[model samples]
Target: MGDRWHIEVDRSICIGSGMCVGHAPDGFDLDSARQSHARATTADANEKLLAAAENCPVEAITLRLADSGETVFPPED
Candidate 1:
């Protein structure tokens, strides 16, 4: 089995840019309020999803290791 990732979007930070959807349409979507949200809370590790997280202008998208809870996107600094 490969790694699984847990995805989250901080609505407080999301600007509804739709950048994530543009990068990975299947991974994210905008709500009626125009906030971005994950299509699934957890998913198989995939590059497109990573790009979606990386491209989020507000850094609202977050990806973490499902089993370990390790940060994947925005780096842990």
Candidate 2:
């Protein structure tokens, strides 16, 4: 298993907050639906990527360990 990660956004919970975009412009964007969407599936999950998820006002962003399908942010409660 590698350290790659997959990013996802729950549109049902998103509030159009631009923190994710501001923190990681290349990682996420507002689609026509006005919801956050991943620019790429297997992203680098760099500091900005994590920050984008971390700064999401609605906590709608989620990061998963691609190789293991483990949730890394907002944690798995």
Candidate 3:
């Protein structure tokens, strides 16, 4: 199984509020332009990633296991 997790965001739904970056700065960043969208540049899966996905106001972010293509959310406690 791959150790990395992939993050995908729907740019059409993203409002560019910077919440994802604020929650997981290492995994996501917002482009500074008109109709900007947050982009996922890293594939690090951790509690922080889960937090960022959950904190997204528009629920634009999707998290998946890179190897198995399984969704990982509402993280295990």
Q: Please, what is the whole-model Cα lDDT of each candidate in the order they appear?
A: 0.94, 0.85, 0.72
Report backbone clashes per prediction. 0, 0, 0
| lDDT ranking from best candidate downward | 1, 2, 3
Q: lDDT per residue, candidate 3, 1-77, as tens digits?
A: 34677777888888877787888777777776422233554476787788888998888888878878777753555
- Candidate scoring better on TM-score of 1 and 2: 1
Give Cα distance to truth, residue 73, candidate 3, Å: 3.3
Query: What lDDT would candidate 2 get against the real structure?
Result: 0.85
Which segments of model 2 are wrong by more than 4 Å?
Answer: none
Cα error of candidate 2 at position 5, Å? 0.5
TM-score of 2: 0.89
Q: Candidate 1 on 1-77: residue-level lDDT in tens? A: 99999999999989999999999999899999999999999999999999999888889988999999999997997
Q: Please, what is the TM-score per model? A: 0.96, 0.89, 0.76
lDDT (Cα, tens digit) per residue for candidate 2, span 1-77? 34788888888999888889899998888877778888888786588989998889889988998888899898877
